[model samples]
Target: MNFFIKLQDKISEFKLQINYMKKFPKIVFIGSTNFSLFSLKELYMKQYNIVGVITSPDNPIHKNEKYFSPVKKYALENNIPFLQPGNLLDDTFLKNLKAWNADIQIVVSFKILPKKVWDLPKMGSFNLHASLLPQYRGAAPINWVIINGENKTGLTTFFIEEKIDSGKILFQKEIEIGKEETAGELEYKLKKMSGSMIIKTLEKIMKKQIKPIDQKNINSLKYAPKISTKNCRIQWDDPSIESIYNKIRGLSPHPAAWTLLFFHKKKFVRFKIFVVKKILKKHSIPIGLIFNISSSEMRISVKEGFISIIEGQIEGKKRMNIKNLINGIKIRKNLFVR
Candidate 1:
């Protein structure tokens, strides 16, 4: 009897939402590549009538003809219309979207939009950036925060305006970053947190219960640009203990902190280090000292202490026990990871 009652209640709620959808503003979501996929999935579960999905064109991958559009795939699977605008500012692009009479738009991990496209949404569009607005606002928030060794960072949802990531914050939530948190881990946490937060903000907007706060002190803003393979390498000559350790943790695991080692002064291989800890010792050892303690743990000397690299791999080689690596490679003494 209780199950039947609950089922009926859910069906009634579904009918109410579907009815409400006809009167509700049409929402067009932009940018559905990464975490945005989850945001769209959540919105669909809420019975939001997404009129269309606007995203970048599908590009070829793997081979010349193999192509994929992440947003288009998701939209097709959910039975929603999709638009892949090669140039967003094109006049025809404007004409097509305005025809939908969308209520508002949502952007997550998208390219910059021109004024013509942004103004199409009647209720005004909004975005959910990974970092706290007015700070760490750029292409790579997660990497920069971890590289700079920040103790805490947060997510911010804001009403999109003229400037990029410089809009009035609608709602913000902070997440305390663990000291050992890598860029990949931080990204995972922030994506999940921000996705739910975006849904909450949208619900509030629908109910007209939100209080917008102006972004102040724009001068304090810092940019976190995209990272390159060049900056991922470990530099032991760096004297600052914390900075070096921070870099090691920031890039470890995926895009691991690497360094170039001279094998027989002829070949160079990039190797990532892990299980790093600074130990104070009196042994007068120079930098890049490879100390073999066991088959599992090999302590490499840094400026302060031995940076224990328990696991790593050379190029085009299998990642195995450190002992196997040392034995296989015949890593000799006096060799430096320059």
Candidate 2:
């Protein structure tokens, strides 16, 4: 009887080990930006079995300065395995990644993965895009949405495909855009939302409860190409004061909307505008004309109305509000923005 009892105990222990092994799937994370860092931290807190992280290599910040990607920094602090492959298709990198035996891969704010890499995982790879899929599908979704004066935006988790951001959707969560919100402010909110949404998505995927929807079925698609220097140049001649305000807010705090300022007819300078307030009353002033200059305020006329320049930075000068900006600079009554 003693021998028989020992034999049954050993069988029970083996079964327990197998069950514990099946409890969590091996997951690999790929990302480089702050958004990726937020999602990675959340997954780590949930005690997910994150096998590895893939991020961009550190870039030179300036003379003798270097900046590492957010994901890389987090992985080092936590002792997580990470790779910063310059070439994703390199054979050694592929072999090492394949050896990890990851069940699924998750990407956020990372470079586009090649087919060979994305297809390595058994359960497949998925990406967390900031905007609703099939819309704002490009490099700078957050900025584009606000630049276009969109009142609503959201996050989308979709399976990876050959085409960029053209994957089938798995989950999404929408949020309202505040009228006065800047791209930087909206980014903070979306980052938090993305972390929670990603966790829920992983759970559903583990339970096999999600149905991937094709992006083609979605209507009213709009593309959000990357923002360029030309795109950031403010066109004061544009007919709408509200639209100009939106543009300023959308690009504020980073790669800000810019315009030309002429102190004298021959002395022109570049100014980056960060914040502006719209004056709804109609103005007969010619477009691009500057007027109503006070010690602490400056107004510029647009096609249909005027805009108060609340905050800006003159070229080669520190950023300041209208009050401090005009403190030493002479303002001509007839001065107009070019």
RMSD of each: 3.5, 4.8
Candidate 1: where are CA atoms >4 Å away?
A: 1-14, 65-69, 218-220, 252-255, 273-283, 318-328
In candidate 2, how many Å is residue 161 off? 0.8
* Candidate 1 per-residue C-alpha lDDT over 27-60 given as tens digits, one digit per residue, 9 for 90 to 100: 8899856667878887787777788889888787
Q: Rate the local accuracy (lDDT) of all candidates.
A: 0.78, 0.89
- Which candidate number has the best TM-score? 2
Residue pairs clashing, model 1: none
lDDT of 1 at 144: 78
After superposition, which runs of candidate 2 have C-alpha atoms over 4 Å from their true positions? Answer: 1-23
Q: How many pairs collide in each candidate, listed in order?
A: 0, 0
lDDT of 2: 0.89
Score candidate 2 by TM-score against the native.
Answer: 0.90
Instruction: List the candidates' TM-scores in order.
Output: 0.86, 0.90
